[model samples]
Target: MTHRTTTGTAAPESGAAVPAVSRTDLPGGIRVLTERVPGVRSVALGIWIAIGSRDENPDQAGAAHYLEHLLFKGTGRRTATGIAEEMDAVGGELNAFTAKEHTCYYAHVLDEDMPMALDVLADVVTNAELAHTDVELERGVVLEEIAMRDDDPEDLLGELFDETLFDEHPLGLPIVGSEESIRGMSRDTLFDFWRGEYTTPRMVVAAAGNLDHAHVADLAAKALTDAASRFPTGVPVGPRSGASGLLRPRRALALRSDDSEQSHLMLGVPGLNRHDPRRTVLSVLNSALGGGLSSRLFQEVRERRGLAYQVYSSHASYADAGTLSVYAGCAPERLGEVVGVVRDVLAGVAADGLTEAEVVRAKGSMRGGLVLGMEDTASRMNRLGRSELDHGRQRSVAESLERIDAVTPEQVSALAAELLDVPLTAAVVGPYDDESELPGALQDLA
Candidate 1:
């Protein structure tokens, strides 16, 4: 196997200099990327797999997440308890999560323990012993998790909104498989998925904080040796791209009637994909609209009217499609007023965009958040992994801040006109029997 290396440093900022990032592509398509933080002793390392729930076939709804839990159950050299004990001995943290497009197994340890951390993480990802008992054990656990999500109004509302907006696309499916699918999943099916999708070419190793790029790459290469040898040489998978063939406003309203204390409502329209150049503009607009406490939704819906205790707008970008939505929880009787206020707020922004002052404040907020959030090693590692998986390139903090600063009011307005002025999709979870019992504003949206 051969190696290719590249290095780049970000432009310096005020207090601390920006860290330098480097990448090494090894034979068999495994890529390792690292960022060296100057004043930190802890290292955050992750093995990022490119397959996620969205990659699952219909019958395999929760296979990716199931694999996440099963990987921690046992591996070739360590039992689940042993894995926990070793990390605890080092006072380190080891965990993992499955997303729409990827899954990550990560650890945080003192820099000196990085080699041990990398080895354990690699073992968990590549050498899991997915026993039948473990599969059954985790199936019950995942089902309980789904039940927990159902019990949370906000969580259930998010799922409902995605279903309404994305229609029948896999992106609309819950990360946790439904009860039927979970019960039906067999051990062999999961093992096959793991062997097929968890290849070196579909993986990235990222580490940050008080680490050397070459040493980290060396550790990764050694740690992943067994897995790397199993596959023939291949090229790393490019970033996910292409249209999300979703029909907009597939259904205007999706409602789940529950006798809860408050009504949960989500209203939104189709949004730009992750690759859209206008995404930064959308970010700035989202900030001004609902990204923070001073955002328009908070001011109009909560501060002034006292309509609801919780109200905000958020946007999510996936590989091919995205969503921009507003969420508000209020008394069942007050759902109408809340909907009216949110609709008016979005309509006003769509019609007139944001003021120059709002845009400036949004940019400053974004810039500060970006810099401050990177104070931890975990955040830095996440940035490296997500950048490589999503765009196949690293974007520096300086470049990000510059892009945020460059967004003009005109650009934001143009995007808002394009994204927010369309037909809206709505999802409701509250004490309502059907659409007829809902407020007229929501019905009008439908």
Candidate 2:
């Protein structure tokens, strides 16, 4: 079948060079995107699948991640050991990760080895054996992973926080399925999930570094030939969108008792979704509030009073929902003071917004971070895949920087006021057995 290709280049900033980006639509609705970077001897290739943990039914919890592990076990054409040895023989890296929204199987190799990299990745993603024995073996590994998460205070706290904020929503569930879910997951269930979700239209093959777009597209087409034949022709799936229906905090507090000396606390409110135009404003607000050492929370909670050893604020933007949260770890005895200070800081921001100078610094930080982060092929490859998957198109660096620079102090202040005013949801992981034992400020949240 004839394939249609389209190409474009990122707009370079003044006196700067940017990579040329291109896309190809192949048979079976598979999309291949490539970015050609100059002066790089290596290529970063990734097979990005849109299916993630949130897409699974309750019974299929953690199936996406479990399938990620099984895919590397072996394929029809190669043994697991052979897959490892081939990549290692060329000093290349092969790995995969599953997230709440997507999964990626990627490889980093010398540009001269792009063919082998593409072929290996395609084979693994499309032709996984998913043997019953492998499923059983991987089940134990996933259970151990869940145990590991439970053992870590901060990790457990994050899960608890999500549960408090999102309630019974799929987003609230742990990406690494619960211990019960993994044990009960049968081989047929996982195989069905793999077959249903890992389709050509749901996949994007992206590569960045020293390579030709046409060459990469051709290689991808050749590599996925047999796999494409199995699926019916379709258009690429659009970016995920839907109302999360999470308009308010489900609960005021979630606490997990752990006998740790330091307490981990995460207090947050729902923020904007990924498609919000004011995301730039929220980013600026987050930066001034807790993004760096100069951030308000850092100075107030750590530097001014020495109440906590580490403190920061962060935000997560999903397709239809997002969160703005602050996390601090400190001595168990200092939990009350830490919570008070964080509350005060957030209140102050909500009432007045960031200062003009703070907004300027935040914008500069955002711009610098954006440029410096793209210096590597891996980062570029990731950006290409995420942009295509998240927005269905590439956004130029110049455009992003412009958006950041255009954010004014007023915009940051307004966004801060709007988001921070929501009723707060809190999570704590420490030596507190119940809500009554928590600090007064935390108890007040409940």
TM value for model 2: 0.97
CA lDDT, every model vs. true structure: 0.90, 0.90
Q: List the residue pairs that clash in candidate 2.
A: none
Worst 10 residues of 1 by lDDT: 9-18
Q: Write the per-residue lDDT of candidate 2 for residues 31-116, one digit (tens) a residue.
A: 99999899999999999999999899998999999988999999999999999999999999999999899999999999999999
TM-scores of all candidate predictions against the true structure = 0.96, 0.97
Per-residue lDDT of 95-169 in model 1, one digit per residue for the tens? 999999999999999999999999999999999999999998998998999899889999999999998787888
Candidate 2 lowest-lDDT run of ten? 10-19
Backbone clash numbers for all candidates listed:
0, 0
Overall local distance difference test of candidate 1: 0.90
